[model samples]
Target: MALKTYHGSCHCGAIRYEADIDLTQGAGKCNCTYCLKARAWTTFMKPEAFRVIAGEDHAVSYHKHDQAPVKFHCPTCGVHVYGRGDADYMGGPFVSVFVATLDDATPEELAATPVRFSDGLHNNWQNPPAITGYL
Candidate 1:
């Protein structure tokens, strides 16, 4: 599970960023309100592992709730590029980068990466949702 730099951006290409992601750790699918609505398929990384390479000003920030992460996206394209959050169980501050936003991930890379599910709708972060068919 070696970390590799992944380039990502928004639908309008207004927000560009780089993140050191270890795909082997698996991408996440959560049934939480926000995640379900966003159809978030993301990879988690330490805050230090992510950096904005361009379009900082064009990135619009949205904080859904106190516990929910501060999400950054492009106002023009409205793509949920990434988000920042803190969870003690996840080892403090972290960034969740949307896999769909990756500008240079090969099909093989994605096929090899695993998918992890969580029951976030019920706040049971440790367990997979009872019905992953929808999430």
Candidate 2:
């Protein structure tokens, strides 16, 4: 998968960022409480692959529980931009960037990428859904 730089912003343009990603790598869907409410389609990348270009001051962080990912959102429009957590947790130091925020994201590009569903609702990573509906 060849990597490419992509730009994105919150719905209200309060939070902006850029990421170097390989769209061929697909994205993730988790059934966790936060994810179920946010409905964000995300992909993980090293912290270096992500950069917050604007609105750090307006972004709000939410941690559901002690070990949950620190999900960041734009307070103005409530768009979930990304999440960060302990370097060792979930194979971080990584940032979970929501692909829907991409400036140029298209239905074709999304349809081309696979969606892997994780059973976060049950804390079961051992068995994830093998197939899911396209985004």
Candidate 3:
């Protein structure tokens, strides 16, 4: 799919944001503690492609023990929206957006988009299992 801008927000409508995403590239399904609990379908994009349109102050961030990928969520509804990390985790510096927060993304679209499982539980980015599935 071609790159497209997608609008999203937290559960209570706070923390509105937009991101330029290409669903044809697929998403990451990580097995880390946070990812496992949140169960979010994530797609990465450059910071320039992401913008906080409104209610940014209403969003809260949680950092894991490693302080990588600070997870952002809405304080009012406690919904995980997206995350960012300074280091290069998946190719280069990127902002990870949760597809579930996307306002216009359909379930069929999500299912059609591919998924790659990441062994984040062990921090093994080099070679994860080849098992594929959808969120």
Candidate 4:
């Protein structure tokens, strides 16, 4: 099935983008420090599935601690939009989309989808099967 398109942007609406994503593809939750602090629910999609509409220059990248993945955030609002991971792990130049940024996503839509949890806090990132609901 064709993925649905969702619009998203930074907190200050500086960085806007659209993502063609399968709502049923499942989302992810990580217990990592940044994830915890950001309180973000995330999802994965191919790089080609996303399109930045505006404010690309307002985006900043940070690669601290584990430099393998470079986190992208809106410099103006400090909102994390995605992360660019190493080619080996990402299978190419892919980014993990921040599910929280999908402002139009409904709770029912999210509930109907699957979700996976990762123990990133302990650096034990497990790729488990998709979950049927939010964590």
Candidate 5:
């Protein structure tokens, strides 16, 4: 698929951003606790590919269990939008955007693409599984 432009924001529109991504590559939806709870769908992109057009101050971060990755969220509405980490953990030097937050794309647009599931819940680094049947 060709690369497409997308725009998204936090709940209440406090934080807004845009990205150029290839939806055909899809995203990762882990069964991890936080992921399951938030129902986060993620797509990886280089940090430079994503731009925070507004509300940078409203953004807060969380790091757990010594994991170098830092999850960024909107403090006001508590939306887990994306994250950045070491090259290895992120599949390279990139930030993984929560596909759920991309406002320009509809759920159908997301469902139409392929997604690879990483065993983030089990903390398995190698051999990540492909998730199926998730809406």
Candidate 6:
């Protein structure tokens, strides 16, 4: 697999980060409560492959009850850029970045990226939702 360096930020530019992602490996689309609300189109990578390039002080983490994925967004822009997973089921130590936040990816790059759907809404993350049209 080949890793591509990507740079991204929140809507208002309050938070900036860089990540190394292997888009050919595929991304994820989930129907979880939070992801649904945010319309998250995301890709996962090792935490070591991602870093906050700026505005760390402006970062705000949003935890959903006892969920393992801690979503981090820009406090100023309220844009969810990425999340850190700590649960084994989530493949611990992973960073899930919202592809929409990727500022440097070309339209062609995103269009060509493969995606997998997940049924997070039903707590069945290992499998895709029955109807993926909404997700």
lDDT of each: 0.90, 0.81, 0.82, 0.76, 0.78, 0.89
For all predicted structures, in order, the TM-scores are 0.95, 0.88, 0.89, 0.81, 0.84, 0.94
Which of the numbered candidates is closest to the native, going by highest lDDT? 1
Candidate 5 per-residue lDDT over residues 1-84, each given as its tens digit: 668889988887888889889998878777666676778788878888889899877889887755546788998898887787
> Can you rank all candidates by TM-score, best first?
1, 6, 3, 2, 5, 4
Of the two candidates 2 and 6, the one with more favorable TM-score, higher being better, is 6
lDDT of 3 by residue, 3-93 (tens): 8888998878978999999988888887767887898779888888999999878788899666468889988899899898766556666
CA RMSD of each candidate after superposition: 1.0, 2.3, 2.2, 3.4, 2.4, 1.2
Please write out the lDDT profile of model 1 over residues 1-68, one tens digit for every residue: 57899999998888999999988889999999988999999899898999999998888888977877
How many backbone clashes are present in model 1? Answer: 0
Q: For candidate 1, list the clashing residue pairs, or say none.
A: none
Tell me the TM-score of model 5. 0.84
lDDT of 6 at 67: 64
Write the residue-wise lDDT of candidate 4 on 17-96 in tens digits: 89888888787877767776777688878888888898877789888765446778998888898776755554667767
Please write out the lDDT profile of model 6 over residues 1-135, one tens digit for every residue. Answer: 868899999999989999999888888999988889899999998889999999887889888677648889987778989988877876777899999999999898899899899899988888999898888
Candidate 6, residue 60: the lDDT equals 92
For candidate 4, give the lDDT. Answer: 0.76
Q: Where does candidate 1 stray beyond 4 Å?
A: none
Q: How accurate is candidate 3 locally (lDDT)?
A: 0.82
Report how far residue 1 has shifted in candidate 4, in Å. 4.1
* TM-score of candidate 6 versus the correct structure, residues matched by position: 0.94
Per-residue lDDT of 1-135 in model 2, one digit per residue for the tens? 768888999999989999998888878887767777788689889888889999988999998797677989987898889888665646757788888899877778878987778877787644565444522
By descending lDDT, how would the candidates be arranged? 1, 6, 3, 2, 5, 4
